[model samples]
Target: MTDLTDRVKQAAAAAEADSPPPVTDLAVTDTALHWLQSRQSYFTDALPRHVDQAHFMSVALSIMPALVKCTHESVHTAFLACARFGLEPDGRQAAVIPYGDKATFQPMYQGYIELMYRHPRVDSVHFGWVRERDQWDYTPTEPSPRDFFHKPRVDLTEDERGPVILAYAFAWIDGKRSQVIILNRAQAEQIRNKYSGAYKKAERNAKRDSAWHTDFDAMWAKSAIRRLVKVVPTSHELAELLKADDDADDTTTAPPVIRGTVIRNDDQADNADNRTTWPAAAEPGSGATADTDGGEQA
Candidate 1:
């Protein structure tokens, strides 16, 4: 009887050792691993090499805690899906790189569009980059002001019409239909200038910057989606996901989770009333403005 018991215990221990540990305590398993492998395989011939299994796993594991903090859930199948969409928990905002470089895996503009459609209240999300003519032609009606002090305004004048735009607007049709629009001339001009400089600088590899300049719509879409999602009230699950995003932008070297971009905030920058002054030529007739109270206009 004693011999039989010892043999059973040894068998159990051996089986346990042979099996792999859970990917994370929250929930990833064979399914997530298999899914990742399949995705990596699908992108085999793509220009920028897809992230290897090891790098993906590293980011996924590091982001799990922030996931828990945001949603009270751990690593799970949905989290895997989220990670697959370029939303990394390691604090790397979508870093754009040249073809040969290790491209940053952050949320794609398209991914955010899909996410908005999935929301119960959001009926549509529209994003675009437009010149004066297009922006003027399709200018949306302004919302009525709720505050007594602020009066409603009229359409843009001929002089004000030509301002370049990176527009992000959405419609909600839950009960009473409503809409929100955000136009960020500041970011639009900033991104344009950066890309234009890159285009001019890259003599040998001009194609990359040229493509970037031509793809202004996508650039605007990405910025719009990032800003809009942060402003809108979402469910706890989505909010938790965004918390990871928020943490990634933290400048502190010793942040709790992984961080990709480091923004050093000075005393002035941290204040709510202070406008961020970018060191560049200001656009004519442009100033920091907000549509919603206590929210960024751009």
Candidate 2:
């Protein structure tokens, strides 16, 4: 009986040693690196050749410090979404924002322009904010053709340009301008109240960290382009991205579940039935300016 018990103890110890370490045992960066490495095939198939493994890893690590405070599953989902969009999360083209303990992928206005330009038919895309002091003109019918014009007051500083009254986005297809979508301040506020859960939460908590609070004009530009895409031709990828943003807009919806290699606590036991349905792609509606140096030209 004593010999048999000893053998059982030895077997159990060996089995425990063979099992993978719990997620908490590793540094957040190490765990993220491991997760990204495991998805090597996925990235290779999804990204262009110029985005090599080293470059991909560097981008992932660049933002891990900020992501460290977020839930592991949320981090994984954010990275997955970032990979799906093929945008770099350098806070310009795209960003991974942390809302409470949840991390959400946000595609910047520049990112939208980047994706729009990818379509073969798309020639140029432009978004601008109209200020009270700016010269603006729009004619639905004149000279046998519709025309729109906006010239920001260059003499005044950005703040001195006065409050923004409108936001507009238009695209060129086959070198011809498409229908322009313009949103007035009231209209833009309605859209924000309707589709921006993050903004609402920030308002409630009085948090100034959200881009919606910090970069209102940029978010307004994004809203204008989002509406413009409805009438314009869009790529399947862009459509999917828009849908993701819509999903994220609904505050009641849960964040997407990480698909594979579930990470759990050291004390937790493996359970085959722990899987949950993956939610729709989630996006946060906060990003930088619509135009920047080196951005795609109209």
Candidate 3:
């Protein structure tokens, strides 16, 4: 009798553990959609830091409200020219400066560590994903940890862990939006080609799931439905509440560094006075279109 009672208690505890605490609102999905519509510079604006601690969105491109032309490099160039024109004689350093990755992936781990360090005080941060490749440089024939570690550049598989598709990034719930925008790109074109399907699917899911949950079938029977929906902006009573945005800056937010990529800037803070504040465009540039490889590098 006592043994039966103990077993009942154990089973109840397991059931409680299995259920997540009452599904506290899906916030990520909604804000990203709105922010994607009308981007606000205040969101992307970072509080200037040292070079080592600097994380920036270099404005690789911009898709305005109406037409569709991605003015990435050239616009960024214009921004720089504006900065130069507005350079101050007696000035403070600018919030943004040129950025590049001299050491590959070092910033990634460092950024991750810093986030972890902020254990309990973290309010919100916006994390983004950019799937760059589809296949690993080397494929593993076995299922061992080492197989995963020293995977063969050839002989890849059709697993989620196989190749990356479209390396994309958007807003998330960290401290700030694009606070840690990660750009994990490789030099392999085939890698980008492989995961193209997954990225497209992700984009589609993002769009569809931007609203509240609708599909009832998955709640009942599916084994693995990601069921990821963005937290709705309407849910937040506080405009000050951390909101995920999907603007050109957010959806296509680029980190200062990726695979040794570098951006050089020498502007002062007062230069904001002269910077061109163009509204979000509709499409990418004449040279820019939906990347045949997958999503654009924005």
Best prediction by lDDT? 2
Better of 1 and 2 by lDDT: 2
Error of 1 at 142 (Å): 4.9
- Lowest summed lDDT window (length 10), candidate 2: 276-285
Give the winner by TM-score: 2
Candidates, ranked, TM-score: 2, 1, 3
Q: Per-residue lDDT for 1-298 in model 3, tens only? A: 0135655777777788995332213352232223233222322232223222112222212211111121233223322321222211111211121211110011121122233224343343333222223323322454322232223233334354443432222223344432222223332223223422322433566642211122212111110100111231122211111111111112234322211112332122123212223222223222422332223334
The worst-scoring run of ten residues by lDDT in candidate 3 lies at 220-229
User: Each candidate: how many clashes?
Assistant: 3, 0, 55
- Native-to-model Cα distance after best TM-score fit, residue 189 in candidate 1, in Å: 5.7
**Per-residue alpha-carbon lDDT of model 2 for 208-265, expressed as tens digits?**
4566776777777788878888866887878877866666655568764323323332
Global CA lDDT computed for model 2: 0.65
In candidate 1, stretches whose alpha carbon ends up further than 4 angstroms from where it belongs are 1-103, 135-164, 175-179, 188-219, 230-233, 246-298
Model 1 Cα RMSD, Å? 23.4
- Decoy 2 TM-score against native: 0.68
Give the runs in model 3 whose Cα sits over 4 Å from its true position: 1-45, 51-150, 154-298
